[model samples]
Target: MSILKLGALRGQLEIKEFLRQRESVVFTLAFPVILLFIFGSVFKNTIAPGVTFSQYFVAGMVASGLVNTGFQQLAIAIPMSRDLGTLKRLRGTPMSPISYFIGKAIVVTASMLFQVALLLGFGALLFGLHLPTSGILWLRFTWLILLGSACSTVLGIAFSSVPKSGRGASAVVSPIVIVLQFLSGVFFVFSDLPKWMQDIAALFPLKWLTQGMRSVFLPSDFAMKEAAHSWELGKTALILVIWLIIGTLLSIRTFKWSEE
Candidate 1:
């Protein structure tokens, strides 16, 4: 079969494997949903004149949630496959390596879409998320999700090299994701963060993703509260594009079919 078609099959298997692991399911998917409630409860007031903190925070969670499904999922999963010698065996198969990466992209994209749908549903039902009605806003939302998924998924595959073994995957990967979420304004207002934190967060794609999401879910005036005092849509798109390229290169350089 063609590599693309094989990749689709691999993606289905990946999703099934992910579902079977209750720990992975809870940590990578459910944890974000739980935090959405915890933070939403503590800061229930309006972030803007009309937008409640729950509403604003939902956008942030959506951004971070994508990171979870994309970055964190592959980061840990790939390493576990390596330590278990799964990748090594797969490498001996007739399947092309690119197909493996393609499978990963599919898994991230599918999981992220479901994740976002759940977040939006929860927000709308309980917190009144108020999704964008404008075509232009929805257009922006579409690209953000596309770019965000590609960026995070490839980066996660590259970052899978960090852990020494499957056992260490979560320990090494989780803290970094947590730190980025806090720094990238997922847990608080971007403008309200320390200047140093703001600058640091801008160095990564998560910050830009959060800002892009905010632009979609919040009013245009809410852009004033961003660190740039503007939505910076152009900048957000550029950063994610750059990172996607860097991540592709890094994954090629770092990818190993075996623990060896």
Candidate 2:
């Protein structure tokens, strides 16, 4: 069979496995929604003149959902597979290592997309979140989601190189995701964060992804709440692209097919 065909098959199996892990899948997708209801309900008042906290938070929740599927899941699964001899066994098969990671990435992207849809649908249905009305805005949102997913997935595989065993994956990756979420304005308003904290968070992809998503869903006038008092679309795309390149390079350099 062609490598592409083999990779596609592997990705299909990955999706099946994801479905089998019903509890994990449910938690991964539902955590953001739960937070949306909790925080969005408590901060029901407007964060800006016309935008309620729920409306303002929809983008961040979407970003968080992508991160959970892209980074957290891969970070745990990849290292666990390595320590469990799954990777070593696969290495002995006809499948190339690239095919393995490709399968992993495809599954991550698909899962993230499902999560994104859920968040947006729930937000619009229950929280009065306004989706992008213009075709151009939707186009912007599409490319941003694709770029953000690729960057986050690659970063996750790169990060998996840090943990030597499945047992340690959470220890190595959880703090990073948690810190990024907090600092990237996932649970708070970016404009309200300290300048130094904003500067630090700006160095990561989550902040830019969240900001890019906000630019798509929020009203144009809402740019006033952003750090630049604008959407910064160009900067957001550029930063995520740069991270994609960097993360791809890092994963190539560090990805392992077997425990080391």
- How well does each candidate superpose onto the true structure, as a TM-score? 0.97, 0.97
State residue 137's C-alpha deviation in candidate 1, in Å.
1.3
Please report how far candidate 2 places residue 218 from its true position, in Å.
Answer: 0.9
The local distance difference test score of each candidate is 0.89, 0.87
Query: How does residue 65 of candidate 1 score in lDDT?
Result: 81
For model 1, how does the per-residue alpha-carbon lDDT over 199-227 read when each residue is reduced to its tens digit? 99999999999989999999889887777
Model 2 residue 108 CA deviation (Å) reads: 0.9
Give the count of colliding residue pairs in each prediction. 0, 0
RMSD of 2: 1.1
Tens-digit lDDT track of model 2 for 1-260:
77777778888999999989999888887888888888878888887877887887889988887788988889988899889898889988888777777788889888888888888888999999998899999999889888888888898898888888899998888888989989998888999999999999999999998888888878889998799898888889899999999999999998888865
TM-score, cand. 1: 0.97
